[model samples]
Target: MSWFRALKDTTRSGLTVERKRLEPLIALRGTAGLAVVIAISLSLFGPAVAAGSAFGGFQAAIATFQRSWRPRPELALASGASLGVSTFLGYLTGSHLFLFLPLLGLWTFLAGLSWAAGPTIGIIASSNVAMMLVTITLPTTVAEAAGHAAMMVFGGLVQAALVILFPVRRWGAHRDALADALAAEADYARRLRHDPVAEFDPAPLMLARSAAALTPRQARTRPAQLHGTRGVAERIRPVLASLADPAVGVPAEGPERDRARELLAAAGSILDAAARAIRHGTPVTIPPGAIAAFRTPDNGTILSGPAQRAADRLGPLLRDVVETAGGTLPEEAAALPPAAALRRRLTRPRRPRAGPAARPPDLAPLTAAAPAAPPYRDPGRPLRRPTLFELVPAAVRAIRREARPGSPVLRHATRVCAVAVAGYLIGGALPLGHGYWAPMSAVMVMRPDFSQTYSRAVARFGGTLVGVALATGVVQLAHPGTELSAALAVLCAGLMYLLMRTGQLASQACVAAYVVFLLGMGGETWSQTVPERLVLTLAGGLLATLSYALYPAWETPRLRTRLADWLGALGEYAAVVVDHYAHPAGKAGPEVRAALLKARDAHIAWQDAIDRAGTEPVRHRGLSNAAADDAAHALHHLGRVAMLMEAHLPERDATPVPAAAALADALRTATRDGARALRERRVPRWGPVRAALEAWDGEGVPDRVVRRGAGMLLEALEALSDALDTDVPPMTVKPAHETDGPREP
Candidate 1:
């Protein structure tokens, strides 16, 4: 892609409006917190101090609004406390340029490195740097600076307290996530009724799983309705696919197909009803038609053998879904109180009993055999979020890991530090009084990727212009007092919070206006602040954007490494599943689960890398676009085959597939070497896999399904090798450290 097209696409994306629901109540709460902080600071310390402290409440509120699984109060407190510390430290060095410039570079670099932790941390840390730049200009002694810092912390505390006292829709994010997953499954089922081979995106289920991970306290206090639904949802997806697929369950078209379609339609209805109930925290009201379809006995006519078994498996899972949704069983709707029963009947009309209502003999049990609180437990690494205290060490380790040469985090830090210092020097040399705006803008807009940095540069500049113009107009026309300025600031902040999800351009515009009013409250006239801010913001944005082109960290070059990682992870997952087949007594053990989780993470990472690489204005050096797509498709097939095998895992005492042992070992060894070969820019060979499969030829593996799945895996691997070998040429790429050596401090 050309630079022009990349820049154009990124700018359009940044400016695009997302029609997300506005959180008016949450915005009001944040704005109210800011209002309180401004009122307190003005009453006690005057408008300038109020202006300085407002960053705490504003930034704290913004932090809480980030898409994080952590509690809102915690995010608020951390944002406030960090800003206070950054302000105090900035004050200590503000008197001397020699001292302050180094401090500025160090702080900005640390802020850049914080991205290694997560986007939330990176964003909050950048805001801290900006707060420091703004607040250190307040002209105060060490004692006075400490007092101002304390007031800032107080502002954060106010926001945190408000969040704890008046949370709007508690656990709302989790509810929406799980609801969306169920809704997605419902849609998939409806689609499969027509197209049996319809593809389903696992992103929603992945997000639902992420939302399920909880802290120890959260685990104990979680709502009962949330438990076990996700697992049942996970199990239902494969069953739906199995029931619909022509090769696996029913024929292309017959009475069995019609029966399958009925079951699918009913499943979709049941799932959609459950989703609605869970999302609204109301009683589940599954359709009476759905209830009847599941209870109808085939009598060995409609769906037989595997199709019948899948249908049977699905019925109990759907029942489990409704039960876990709100414990509103099909048979118990009439037993509720008059109003409740009426509501249930309106939505979940009673269905006639099909038989004794006894649970099917072949029905799979729920989590009864496992620990009681399965849903609330901290899942494995990908979904397991660390507590704030735990995060300190984890963050430290992350920074240390990214400290080496070739690390994108390190490169970003270096580039940001360099640009910030240069922008500061240039701004200071110019006549603009607000020299910090230039460096602050540069720091805030820069990210590890090209698209965000460029897009944000456009957003920040455009937003700054509109914001300055509007605030200047308001100031000149109304000639408002300190109190009115504070009110306007709060209003702008509320708008910012409300539009937080509506893309960067919109929110940044409000942010610009808010800052203007904040400074106006500090007694700075529009003339003194407006022009300086506008000019300095432009300078800073340009510096940040230009620095990327000079010191680029392209994802295109790292595509092979990411693809290799995915291959290795996928192989391990396949081997683990095959190993389980080899030793049926083990079932799906922790190792298998862990491997599966790792592979999924790797898959997500690979897709993310591909996406990032696609937007970059660089050539595909090692892997072309077609090759990547083909390889991705092949890997996806490999994952699906493994998932199918996992769905049909043998019973604990079932006859073991002796051939699976050798096949699993070969997969583990061959994929390990294949990944290495890919990394070294050589075509991968699956000779071991071929040999292992050949050894079982004509011997007939005890489990034909396992053998078939293993054969599919081998085919996928071969296809992947062919995809890579067709276009990939031999090349020696330098290690990241060698290519981008770390600068000496």
Candidate 2:
């Protein structure tokens, strides 16, 4: 039961979007689109190769239909080029065993190199491999090979035309990314108002980060500049978090704190307005004093105290947001609240906090984005990259990068090439019919990491057996003609495409049906091909699994390095943000942004490593899973706090706080020492961090500013220490009232 509960704790069901609910409509569109292309080809080639052309059309559509707006010409060209090269290799390898084996290994090896460019290029490479694996074992000459490749290209052209004509959601991804972030911010703000120091789930923020990943190169800009809607979303998270810092005394026992909470609530209202404005693409209309209210502080709060500091931090950020959001500041900045009632109707109420088991669905915010530039391009225009001329140099560079001994891509590619060669040899040395399926299956099943490889192998084998039986049964029952078989193939292709994002098993099942029906249209009967396909697929999966079992890409060896990397980056990020607070001179420069990006990248890398390691074999060395997870959770919490610290980073130069500077230095030292300890196998000291915060007396104005930041930092650091030093489950994070008291490290 305990293990089951832990397993549940780790599930990220919150991140998933329910695509299955919309699959039926997606399937219909996909089927109709592919069928139209295939129907035309049937008239030209009839049954001889109509099936191949149709399958090509299906594959083209499936591969190219991503969240972003792809240029139709680029899709047609990339697909055609991949098909052309893979076809040449397939034809070359079909006859000559001596030359074929070595070249096949080399080709697979090179294909792995494609990953360095990006996943977009990586997908193209993998598709090329898959196509060739199917084509190479075919009984065809050079002339027939050209015809087959042309048919594939023709199929791609059809899909491209469909895309151009249909013109579906072009800016959907960017829109969703922005909307999700704002929604999450609103949710976080709502929770903050309820319980300023509560341990809120960080999953929604993670979801927003993941959603905001598809940044357009054209949209890249300076720190003060608005890159995209995502940039605004990123900026607002810290503001919301800082406002809710319990140790900052924004909600502590005082009239001044009460006033600060009201201001925080007002700031939240502005966020709501911004979210709504972005959602509808309207100019922002905040309450008259919303912007000005933050600028002019109430004199009742102690000078440079928590209330004054929170207001000081939120002021410039609010002003920047107003400019970015295209909001107009009223001439009389003091007439606040009720006057902004016109805009109030446009905003939404906060959602009720979800139960623990409630998976995150979506968020809608009421805030605005800081817009610094006009749109890079018209939203209606489909974005395109520089074409294939640049690919040669990129591919060469990728190969060079992958040649490094420690490169993950190099290791993975080597494994794939070795496995492919082995499967090909085993198939050729036996009596299996068109045994290339074995090699194809092996390559397809072998993922870069162990978890994916094992999972995919199981899915491929099980889905194939089930699919073969089901497809064969349907074919025997219907005994359809050539045209009907072609239709069935198209239908299967469409359904497979729709189901791909929903479930791997369902997609694989449809793939089996599609293949069976497609080959049947080419005069290969189900009875003759089903057994061969089944046997080869099973063999391929087994071979792929056994290969990994023998020489596993275990995450244990990489886990320590990743953890150290994350800690180092986190420390740097925290220190930098702290320094900016201590010395807010030129806060609008690029240095802070650069540091934040590095930290975010490192955090992502560590999480990815943890996930992959979880999928490896159970006998992990160097560290246990529970300890690793706790460590990651600790770091993630630190990262969240650091992000908040960054959001409220002061904009004007201030007298440096000695205590704050000391704490900053301590963060740097601890990170360096901790990383070294983690890597070299030692228990790192947390004394410096705890001691620095304790000795910092909040005596004067400057020290008070430092105290606010130091207080929050100490609490976060202590949480990190607790997670690292103990085996306790994470309980509610209350304010650490014992910062000045003796503590166990």
Candidate 3:
């Protein structure tokens, strides 16, 4: 009884898992079924009708493949080649049409090659028309001619069906990907607000790119698909504008008012960042004093001095809304203090004497025997930016650019054509008929990814060899007669269906084997053809390799310029972040969100550029690497700061102080110090002094809380400076609690 119960439970669990896995497939089944129905309908029609439909279908499929296969051109070409080979072999042996086999093989190979190279539907249709004419003259029997024609038509129809079904299912996937990306960004922002140990990271940026790449058909929409959920500009525009309008007074309700006020504050910060990005491309540099003030814990009232000054600068309507709402703002709302003031207090102004200029040590030396790293992993350092070669289509594009117009592709095509011509010439000279293996091998070897090409070549060779052996055995079992031949033909159709469903490579082998067997049953022996095909195949591969090596191709250049451009953009983005923090509540948030999106787009572009750079030849490597790494680090830090500012804005604004002059002086000083440090190539130290000033400026927070938060921020800044070897300065300001009531400008 116990065992039986356990068995029942296991069965139930298995059923649950199966149902879960099958759900998505079931949802997509309708479209898949539609494609299958079209293929089956075409097959049911008589050979003549099927032939007409096949021509049109093949043309459409080739055109679509060209447009969609930009990133994976080799795969498209291979698929076409596989189709042509299967069709030719099917007709040669299945219908006992030995005399027409060589002609059919050549025609199919040329047609497939042209389609793969240029993808013109019209050209393919024309090729089919020629094939139809040849079929009438070359086939000794009507049935044989009809069977070959039908194979061509069916092959074309299948290609068309697959293309139509793929895109429709991708749209929903993109939406889901976007939602996941936004949620991840929000989570990262929240973590920055709560965790002091955490530093900025570009994982979020990477996630965003991945999300963007997903096709829409695959995306699933959730409630968070609304722009507001992602902190996008569209979400904050209304709230920011409302805050500047006096008519919409702060709500009298409790939680409702709180939510409204919080939204308004967030919007203000976003707008401020956007405005700053427009004014200057670099990130807004935060004074150490401002960081200290926000870190203070005693309700942040001690920081109100600079906050009030910022409020005074706002238009009347916005000031009224804040006052009436009884809402506080973030400490960063006070314009950042100067870097010079912070630097003067923290360290001497003189530059460090140059020896080695504090060079960072290289962790790994170059070695021939060292294992190469995977594309996703950094070649050396943990946080290094990816090189261009790691990316796919970019590498191919870069190579293409090196050659003159249409050189690399055209050169390859020409070599393939030459191999076929040579094969025909050799056949004529020897009186053994044109060899199909030479041209077929050329198709197998043409690939952008070396690994894929290698695998396919092996598979093709193995499958063909096995197929010929199997044909010998089958012919020995069944004599050459019409009834046996017809039975074998039916068996080939079943094999085609199975192979198509299994995989292209596997199917190709199966088809080849069936063809060999059919030929033997028709009185031709595999022992007579096997050795000849192998030799021809070797000839084709050699020609293909020669063409690829000799073709004019572009070498990948150093990607430093692209990386530098991205770094410059990131600097600008950081400046915008500072502006967002400095702006008065209700004035900065909307615009800041817009700026964030721009930054996100810029990062995506940088990734693409890097991918392109990596694929280039060994020359000009590691050019933009340093700049890209620095930019990534900066963005991670800025994102964290933005989250913190958003979380504390309301509490900080409630403080009242009169330290505007001191804060501004401190900010100016810090900015100057930072500029000087950058020039000197030294890390600046200003966090301690900034913390002291923040402790002194704020009046609302209990002295201990203000002191502790300020201390933490100061320590954090010091760590950052040490990590990046760059200096930052402190800002000065008076405590907000010491301020008199609202002051005149």
Candidate 4:
């Protein structure tokens, strides 16, 4: 990509407004917290103290809005306390530039390292550094600084108190995450009705899994409805796929296909109903038609073999979903396998017995209290995330791992630290009244990636211009007193919260206006601050952009490594799935689950690298665009084949296919060698995999699904080999896989 194209794309990205639903109530609540802190501080110590303290409430409110599983009040408190400490330390050295510059560099570096923890921590830590620069200029003496710092902490305390006193939709984020996952599955079910082999992105399920992780306190207080449903959702995806596949399950043109369509439609409706119930904490109303379809006896007859089995599995799972949604689920119900769970209560017996007919029980809300059993854990435990405090040592280890040459985090840290110091020196030398604005802008806008850093810089500068103009006009027209300015500042803060989800441009615009009004309350004139702020902000943005251009950590160079990682993970996943066919009694459920998770993570990493690489002004040296696209296409099919095989895994006591053992070994060996060859920039030859597939070429295999998928897998690998060869013309390339066609009965 050329520099001009990169710049144009990033600018468009910066200007793009995401069409997300606005949370007015939550934003209003956050604004109210800011209002209380400002009102109280203004009453006690007048406008200047209020101005300094508002930063605490303001930043803390932002922190609470981060996408973290931790409690919102806890986030608010931690953000507040951290900002206070940063401000106090910054004030200590504010008198001497010699002392402050060193402190600034060290603080900036540490903030950069905080990314190892997670984006939430990294964002909060970066804000801490930015606040240090802005707040240190407010206090004149050490005693005064202590008082100001205490007031800031008090601001955070006020927000936390407000959260406890008037909670809004408690456990709301968790509910939303769980609901989104179910909704995605519902959509997938609908799509599969037409395109049985349609692809489903697992991102939503992954998010729900992350949301399920809880602190001990959260676990104790969790709502019963939120428990166990996630596991049921996980089990449903495979069943849905298996039932829809033409080769293994239903026929393409027959009455059985119509029955399959009816089941899928009913499943979609049930899933949709479940999602709504889970989201709003309401009673689940299972559609009468959906229940009737499941109860239809011909469902068992028309859908025979794998299709029948999948239909059987899906009915019980959906029942659990409805029961769980109505809060009527037995706490110990999760311990039962999906095929056995809720069978007597929700599902009618498949055959009539020599007994009286009983009506199927309605999923009524049950209030009986039993000791909650430890929840059914996922095989790989991929959903488990460390608590914030627990992440400290892990974060330290990550930082240490990145403390080497060519580590992107290390390069980013060094780049940011250098740019901040330089921006500060330049801003001070130019006689800017608020020199801190320069470095603060630099710190806030400079991210580890080219796209974000550039987009944010563009957005920040544009937002500042609009904001400063609007704010200065207000001050000039109204000639408002300190109290009015403070009120205006509160209003602007509210607007920022409301628009935060829209885009960086909208939120940053409000932030600019809020800051202008905030500083106005502290007796800084619009004339003195407005022009200086605009100029300094531009300088900071320029410094950040220029620094990246000079010392870039291009994702293009790491593309091969990321691709190799994904190939290896996908190979392991395929091997585990195939191994299940070879040794049915081994029950490699945990291993398969773990391998799938690792493969998913690697896939995400590779895609992210590609996106980052696309926006970088660098040549694709080793891997051309055409090659990368072809390779990714091939790998995607390989993964889908593994997934399809996993859906048809044999039961524990089922007969093992001895031929699968050789294929599994070949997959492991070939992919390991392939990854090594990829890293070394050589065209990998999958001789072993090809040989293994040839051995099964003409055999009358009992396990048709495994054999067919292995053929598809080998085809994908061969295509991958051609992609990496570089000798093949991009225009002559052919895809290994095709959209699956419906089969006749």
Top model number, TM-score = 1
Assess the local accuracy of residue 687 in candidate 1 as a C-alpha lDDT between 0 and 100: 96
- Local distance difference test, each candidate: 0.80, 0.60, 0.36, 0.80
Q: Looking at model 1, which ten-residue stretch has the lowest summed lDDT?
A: 366-375
Instruction: Point out the higher-scoring one by lDDT: 3 or 4.
Output: 4
> Residue-wise lDDT of candidate 1 within 501-543, one digit each (tens)?
8888889889999998988888888888888888999999999
- Segments in model 4 whose C-alpha atoms lie over 4 Å from true places: 329-385, 586-588, 696-700, 728-745
Worst 10 residues of 3 by lDDT: 736-745
How many pairs collide in each candidate, listed in order? Answer: 1, 13, 94, 0
For all predicted structures, in order, the TM-scores are 0.90, 0.77, 0.39, 0.89
Model 3: lDDT equals 0.36
Q: Which stretches of candidate 2 lie over 4 Å from their true place?
A: 1-33, 66-76, 137-139, 194-228, 252-403, 658-666, 686-701, 711-745
TM-score, predicted candidate 4 vs. hidden true structure: 0.89
Residue 310, candidate 1: Cα error in Å is 2.4
* lDDT: worst 10-residue window of model 2: 736-745
lDDT of candidate 4 over 1-745, digit per residue (tens) = 8999999999988877798889888899899999999999889988878888999999999988888887788788888888988899999998899999999999999887676556777788899899879898888888877878888888778788877887877788999999999999999999989998787777788778878887667776777667778987987888788788786778887988898898899889889988998888777766777766775356656777778777876776777677566644434444444433443434332221111222323422111111111122322222344555765677787677666677677678888899889988998899767888899999999888899999999999989998999998999999878999999999999999999999988889899999999998999889989888999999999999998999987788788888888899999999999988988843337899899988887887787788899889999856999999999989987887888788778877788888888999999999988887777677788999988878866555886777878888898899998999975323232212111111000
Which residues of candidate 1, in runs, are more than 4 Å off?
328-384, 733-745
lDDT by residue for model 3 over 1-745, one digit each (tens)? 1334433432332222111112233223322332332345334643233333333333233333222212222222333344444344434553444544455445534443343223332243223423342224233554644554444454444444454444432223323333343343334323323332245334344443333332222222211121121223222222232222222222244433343334334324323322232122222222233222212222123213322222222222222122111222234333323342243235322222211222211101111101111011111111222122333343344333422333323343444445445543454355444254555555544443222233344555555666656655676676545335434533543454333334334444555665454343344456655666666655655555454445423222313333333333433443343333334343335555555555555555455545533433234332234534564455444333333333223222543323322332443345335434433334445643474367455643332222333333334344435454423222232111110101000
